[model samples]
Target: MKGPLFYSKILLFGEYGIIKDSKGLSIPYSFYNGALKNDGNASEAALNSNQSLKRFASYLKDIDQDLVRFDIDKLTDDVNAGMYFDSSIPQGYGVGSSGALVAAIYDQYAFDKITVLENLTREKLLKLKQIFSAMESFFHGKSSGLDPLNSYLSIPILINSKDNIEATGIPAQQSDGKGAVFLIDSGIIGETAPMVSLFMENMKQEGFRNMLKNQFIKHTDACVDDFLKGDIKSLFKNTKQLSKIVLNHFKPMIPQQFHELWKKGIDTNAYYLKLCGSGGGGYILGFTEDFEKAKKALSAHKLEVVYNF
Candidate 1:
């Protein structure tokens, strides 16, 4: 038995800012994806996924019926029958690995689930976000559910704020364009819970809270707006500001080795680096007006371009 595939997601503009009700832009990353399959063999990876699914099934059964209803019995039976998630999405990469898993489960097991084919009204989008948040919280202590939502709908999601979101169309990618948005591998896995916890701790400081509201969120919102409107100049400008703010404030979230590299982008104007997700060590996002220049500057590291403009 196999279910349809769900793609990974990239929260392009908002990472930590969204937690504070900042505007966010997320797009599907089709380069990595996952699906559920029953191989009837207990390979180590499959068994591990099956065990995780078992725990997830139990958690789903405990959710309030008014919130979401799932076929818990069927989920359990499938796990027992060696059903596991067959995925290539890397965990701890901030690319929505667990989110794809959640989306797949919700798609397969949720009773009366909102099909992606339906006309997704604002109300339906919010409901899906709420349900996904509740379901994904089992993995992360708290969640916005944006990752799973992006993966499930396979479209760009624009979050005006926590309560307001919609499907959005981004600027068309230009194949011949020199500007690009890319990902740099940190080669270290990051756990979401700890990074999130650290962010929460930092939120307690009045100075940090002020910085988040005044600087971080403001730039993020602008970046989102500029990207959607196809304002390349303003998008790059705001992205540079946002990158600087992240470097100054989100230090711990940035892996130590990349600190100079992050700053060099700002200094050289070759590219701007920012957190991809809950960054401790995962993929750091890079934006450059000239892809060739940025590639030349960071020749030592592995870079994967996500979009071109």
Candidate 2:
């Protein structure tokens, strides 16, 4: 038996900025997806996933029942019966693999679940974020719950700040357009906790805080607005700045081998590279007005185009 499918997500505009209340935008990436499945002859991967689910089920049991509760009995029964998350979404790649899993479990088994059909008011959305935050925290030590929310809703989400978020519509993708947003696989996993800790540690420095406020967040917010408004020129300009700031200030989060590649994009107008998620070594997000030019410039690497405009 296979449950509903939940897609992966990409934080187009915001990465580390949202923690400080920067405007953020996230879109659902239909390229990779996950689902809950119970297979008769569980493969090794399925067995491994089932074991993880057993532990996750135990964690859910102790979660705040006031916010949300699950059919722990049935969930456990399924787990014991070899239920597993059959997913193509890669973990630790910053594409919301765990978020998809959380969304699928919530969709399949949660009691008094919030249906996507209901009028999603600010209060309701906020409540969903809070519940998702709590539920997803079992995977990440801390979570904003945005990933699961985006995957569950299967739409673009605009993050105004820490307290305000809403479902938003982005400009239509031009199938034949030259400009594109793509992913460069680092081909290595990235850990969220360490990268986040490094950011927090950097927060203690006065100069770092100043730069984050004056440059990093400013560019990120502008990129969000530009993308939403469909101002391609302005979006590219701001994204260039954002990419540079990430390379200069958030160096540790970026993988070592890609450092020069990231810089090359900024130096030339061919493309702009930014952190996909925590960015130790997952998928590096790339934006370019001419996909052909960007691909030629970095022909050694593999590129997966997610959006075109």
Candidate 3:
């Protein structure tokens, strides 16, 4: 049986800032997607996914009493039927592998959940986020629920400031343009828990907070603005700045062995690298107007373009 499709998501802007209610923007990336499938011969990944889902189902059942949106019966039945996630999205790569799974569960199993078709007011969106956060927490130790929300909604979402978000639009891609935005596989698996813990520890330092407020957040906020306004030139300009700031201040998050390669891009002006998600490894995003140049510069690593601007 085929269930609804859940596409992978890219947090184009706002990684840690969203935690503090800073402006954030996310767009659906269609290259990688997942869906519910009932396959008789479960692959290794499928079997592992099924086990994870069972644990999540149990967690949902236990928490259902205190919560209101989950549909326990349907989820339970599906678990019994050997339901598993069949996805192309890579795990531990910060592309929302778990989030896609969570979104599929909500779309296929939730009995009284908010419909993406409804008005989706801030109140409803916030409630959905709360329920999804609790549900997705089984995967990530903590979650804001934005990943599943975006996957389920399949629309450009803008966080107007914290506590407020709504669907929005991006400028249509130019098929013939030379510029592009894409993902570069770091060839290393990034663990979310450790990286998040590191960020939390850094937050305890006065200097860290200062950098976040003055540098990280400022460039991030600008990138979001330029992206939405369709100011391509300014967007890349600020993205390069953000990439540099992340390289300098968030060194712990980047894979230590890749430090030199990361610096090479910035110094050479071939491509600018930034964190794709939580960053202890995973997929680091790269931006370059000239795909050919970026490809040549990053020849040793694998790269995938999401859009050609």
Candidate 4:
């Protein structure tokens, strides 16, 4: 048995800033995705996945029914039959591996689920976000539900603030353009909870809060606006600023090895790197005005281009 696939997601802008009511833009990364499957094989991976699903099912059962309800019986029966998630999305890479699983489960078993084909109003979007938040909390200690929502919708989402979000479109990708957005593999895993905790702790300092509000969020908001408007010059300018600010303030969140490379980007102007998601390690997002030059500068690393403009 196999269920529908749910794709991974990338928060293109507003990583930590979104937590403080800053604008965010998330897009579906269709290159990696997952689905629920049952082959009746008790292989170690399948067994482990099945057991994990059992725990997740139990967690779902305990959620307040009035808040969100699932077809618990069906879920239980499937798990008993050796169901497991078959996925390609990398875990702890900040591309929403668990989120795709959560979205697939909700799509398959949630009662009165929001169908993707339906006309999604603001009210429906909010309701889905709330339900996904509660459901995904099982993975991350806290969640905004944006990951699951993006996977479920399979579309770009624009977050105006914490309370306002909507499906949105991005400027068309220029296949032959020199400027590009890419993901650089850090070749390490990052845990969301710890990184988030660090951010929260940093928030306690008045100076950190000020930088976040005045510089980080400001640059992030501008990047989002410029990207949406197809103002490449302004977008790159703000992206460079955002990248520098993240380097200075979010140092701990960054993996130690990339410190020099991150700084080199700003000093050399080949590429500006920023945290992809809760970055202790994993993929670092890169923006460049010239992909070829950036590629040459970072020859030792692997780069996956996600967008060109």
Candidate 5:
């Protein structure tokens, strides 16, 4: 049986900053998605996906009962029948690949599930986030749950803070606008856990903590506000500062090959690069006033435009 599709997500802003209660904006990326389906062949990807689902089902059963309940037996039976997640969302790209998988499983197997059709109050939204956080933590040792929440709802979400979040609407994309936001393929897979670990380790230092508050989060929060308010000029200004802070303080998370590339954006204003997820690799996010100029600047790399200003 095939389940309803779950789309991937992009944390347009608030990557690492969200961990420290910074505001974040995430949107559903329909360009890639996934769904649960009966495996018809023993393809390597399908086989591995089926096996992973088994482990995830077991882990769900072990989660605190108060948070959520699933039809574990039925889930098990489906896996036994060779049901696997068939997806095109690239893993480790910071685009919420596993998040879509988690959303699909919850939609199919979770009992007393929250329906997107219902009027989503703040309380209900937070509850869903809590459940998803617990469910997704199985993959990442720790999780905010926002990724799966965005994927599950298939809508934009605005994180006001750790305890305050709500559905949001972003400025409409301009069809012929020259300014744009894009994703640069780093050509290397990034692991969230280790990058998170590195951030945590750096947090132990007072200097890093100061930089996070005075610089990183400051610019991150500003960027979110500017983007939502349809202030393109201001958004780029803040993003430039944010890019510089990340390059200076969060070096480990960035792949060495792209350090020059990241700086070049800030220096030339062709595009400002930021960590799409945890940086180490995967996709490096770019914001540019002129897509054509940015394209020319990074001609050697693969680029996919996500939004136009």
Candidate 6:
């Protein structure tokens, strides 16, 4: 059976901020998508996915009955029916690969789950977040459930604060603008669990907390505001600072080899690069007003344009 597709997600802003009740924004990325399909090629990927879903079903069953609920029988039936996730989104790159999968499963198998047609009010949204949190914990060890929620809903999700989220709109991508926003694949996979654990450990240090509050989150919050206000110039300026801050303070999250390339953008003023997801090795988002100059500066790497004006 063919099921609705779910796309990957990009957390445009509020990576670590939303956890602290900072304003956040996330948008669906359609370039990479996945859907549930009945297929005979139960190869390694399919088998692995099947095992994962099975484990997730068990986790759901094991959860506190009052806190989360789902129809396990139906999910089991679908799994037995050769349901496999056929997807292009890369796994472990921090770009919602597993998030899309989790969303698709929830959309299809939850008997009493909220439907897309139903009014997804704030109450329902919060409930879904709770359910999805328990459901997705099978994959992430710990989860905020925001990624799958964003993918399942396939809309721009704005986090006004930690307890609040709603669908929102972004300024339409400019058609005639000279600047471009794009993705630069790091050509390596990144595991979320370890990266998150590292972040948690770093949180214990007073110095790290200070950097996050005074510098990293400050510039990040500015980038989000400037972007939403359509202040392209300021957005890029803050993004450069954010990129540099990440490069210096978040060195562990960045792959070692790309350090020079990361600094080159700041030193040359051609482009500013930042993490797309948690940033161990996934796709890095790049901002460049002059595409040609950014391209020339980083000609050695592959670049994919998400939007151009």
lDDT of 1 by residue, 141-244 (tens): 89999999998999999998899999988989999999999999999998999999999999999999999999999999999989989899999899999989
In model 2, residue pairs whose N, Cα or C atoms come closer than 3 Å (at least 3 residues apart or on different chains), thus clashing, are none
In terms of TM-score, how similar is model 5 to the real structure? 0.99
State how far residue 133 of model 5 sits from its true place (Å): 0.7
Q: Which digits, one per residue and each the tens of the lDDT, describe model 6 over residues 1-309? A: 788889999888777666666677888999999998876666898887777777777777778777656688987887777678889999877778878988988888776778778988998888888877877888889888888998999988888776888888888987787788888888889888888889899999999899888888788888878877888889888888998888988888888888999998999989988887788898888889999899999898898887775
Residue 101 lDDT, candidate 4, scale 0-100: 94
> For model 2, how does the per-residue alpha-carbon lDDT over 7-32 read when each residue is reduced to its tens digit?
99999988999989999999999999
**Residue 210 of model 6, lDDT score:** 90
lDDT of each: 0.94, 0.93, 0.85, 0.94, 0.92, 0.84
Model 6 vs truth, CA RMSD: 1.5
- Candidate 3, TM-score vs. the true structure? 0.95
lDDT of 3: 0.85
Give the distance in Å from residue 126's predicted Cα in candidate 6 to where it truly belongs: 2.0
lDDT value, candidate 2, whole model? 0.93
Deviation of model 3 at 302, angstroms? 2.0
After aligning candidate 3 to the native by TM-score, how far in Å is the CA of 231 from where it should be? 1.2
Cα lDDT over the full model 4 = 0.94
Cα misplacement distance, residue 2 of candidate 3 (Å):
2.4
Which stretch of 10 consecutive residues in model 1 shows the poorest summed lDDT? 38-47
Deviating ranges (above 4 Å) for candidate 2:
none
Clash count, one per candidate:
0, 0, 0, 0, 0, 1
